[model samples]
Target: MQIAITGTGCYIPSITIPNDDFAANNFLNSDGTPIQHENRLVIEKFKAITGIGERRYVEPHLNTSDIALLAAEKALTDANIDKEELDYIILAHNFGDVSSGQSQSDTIPSLASRVKHLLRIHNPKCIAYDLLFGCPGWVEGVIQACAFIKSGMATKCLVIGAETLSRVTDPHDRDSMIYSDGAGAAVIEAVENGGKILSHATRTFTYEEAYFLFYGTSYRPTAKNTKYIKMYGRKIYEFAITNVPKAMKECLNESGAGIEDVKKIFIHQANEKMDEAIVSRFYGLYDRSMPKDVMPMNIHKMGNSSVATIPTLFDMVRKGNLKNQSIEKEDVVIFASVGAGMNINAVIYKV
Candidate 1:
């Protein structure tokens, strides 16, 4: 069975935070001039170098499921399929609807069930669950969906990677300034032809060196803070430069395809430097074996939507004016991601 992505769609909040607005709100002195060089200055430089103009954030009271529903509806409509046709619904989110509550009940029920009910899908044997990896959660979700379809457990699956990082952000912190809210969905089905997921490879390095960034609950003896994102930039950059290209090579080799066979590379939108490093390493290893291509990145615009990055980019490609660009069937599309858990995953598709 060939598992293919039939449709892709994304939803971003209506409000956009422009760079100037961000700087003014977070980095300006009383005289309206930029403050001295520091962490804030670095973040501003990140915005400028990455060319991210603005990012969206949901309303104060909104949740991840709300953004997800909007994107999911668009995806189903684009695929010419109904939500009732879905056999499985997998949600990948680092931040949930109820994150700090003591209720042991799964958060998926409230969000996913509501979505299914709104679409009028009665008792569809829905599996509403959250997959909590870091940025790579979406790629992991895709791999899991393919496995479910291939195992005859499902015919169609709605895989969503949505995040509301802004909900956990510390407004006073510069790192949190880049974080935004968005959702992306894909309607995947078992198809006889077209793009087929051929190979997947995952690798993990766990140690203090591997621990670069994190956003979650922290246990403290007296008081614990569960809502914040922490990052060690240097360590993250080091890990990305070392691990990402190596993982990509492994996936490419396992698929029996050379780097040249890949038409377009879709990497997790971690950072501009990481993207450039991966591309450079691939070309260095292949030495003219790599194809000249463009990789879409949105880290500057949306910071990191955690798991939503890859699927969101896919949705952007589908909806954007890239239709004028020359792309054809059977061209290999490679998906790669590295996340905070020190986890990395890469997969190839014959699209």
Candidate 2:
């Protein structure tokens, strides 16, 4: 029996917010001081480093669980499986369902439970739960599902990564432009013939790295006690470049696949420059130059949706929606991510 992802789907929000749209934002320094650079200059520098020109936001009426349900339905249709057959439903995210115009997150029922309810699956045997592992949550959920399958505890599982970062963003924070809203889901099962998961590795660093990303007050002093997603951009970049590549290399080596066999890599869409640096260092370990088109990035348009980025990009590429990026049978690929917990994880798969 081979563990595999049978179907995948994603929800890309309709509302687009361009970089120019942020020009009017009253941007402020973390210390509540005025920025010397103009909004245009700041945006240009941001675009150059992160490659994000725009991002999507959910409709006023929609929430994280709502989009999750949409993606789950599409995944079920693509898998052609009975929802009741699923033995587990795992939802990965940071903030829960933050309704539009609200600052607080709602996670009482758990996003996984909410998705299961929305799917109308009444199977009590189908365990539903939420996982908060920073942006690597989805990848970690997939690994957990594989563990269940391997240990004879489950036959099938549904793993989803969803987030509505727009609701928790601070208008005064420039880093807010890097956050967006999206959801992605995949059906995992043991198959007689299909793509297979080879190996995976995960790590969490709390030694002075735990707060690389966190919730903090707005840059504006008068914004009160309201919290928003904030990060030490330079610190996170340094942490990721130093640690992510090592985890990826370890995962690839454990998979027993040669470096030359890798055809594609789906990494978290945090920053374009940081991603490029990580991949470059990874290949350098094998004494080879990074190959062209080995990585397909959607950050230019999607920004960073935290846990949702990798699986969403995977769905897009699988459906042939990403130009010049596709996978084939027996192809070796890697999925990797880094985020708030200072967490890092990587998975090697054969398609």
**Tens digit of lDDT per residue, candidate 2, span 1-351?**
999999999999999999999999999998999899999999999999999999999999999999989988988899999999999999999999888888888999999999999899989999999999999999999999999999999989999999999999999999999999999999999999999999999999998999989999999998879899999999999999999999999999999999999999999999999999999999998999999999989999998999899999999998999999998889999999999888999999998
Worst 10 residues of 2 by lDDT: 96-105
Listed per candidate, the RMSD to the true structure in angstroms reads: 4.8, 0.6
Model 2 pairs whose backbones collide? 330-351
- TM-score per candidate, in order? 0.85, 0.99
lDDT score for candidate 1 against the true structure = 0.73
Report clash pairs, candidate 1. Answer: 330-351
Model 1 error, position 124 (Å): 3.8
| lDDT, candidates in the order shown | 0.73, 0.95
Q: After superposition, how far is residue 69 of candidate 2 from its true place, in Å?
A: 0.6
Q: Mind giving the per-residue lDDT tens digits that candidate 1 earns over 170-195?
A: 44445566667888998889988867
* Residue 113 displacement (Å), model 1: 3.9
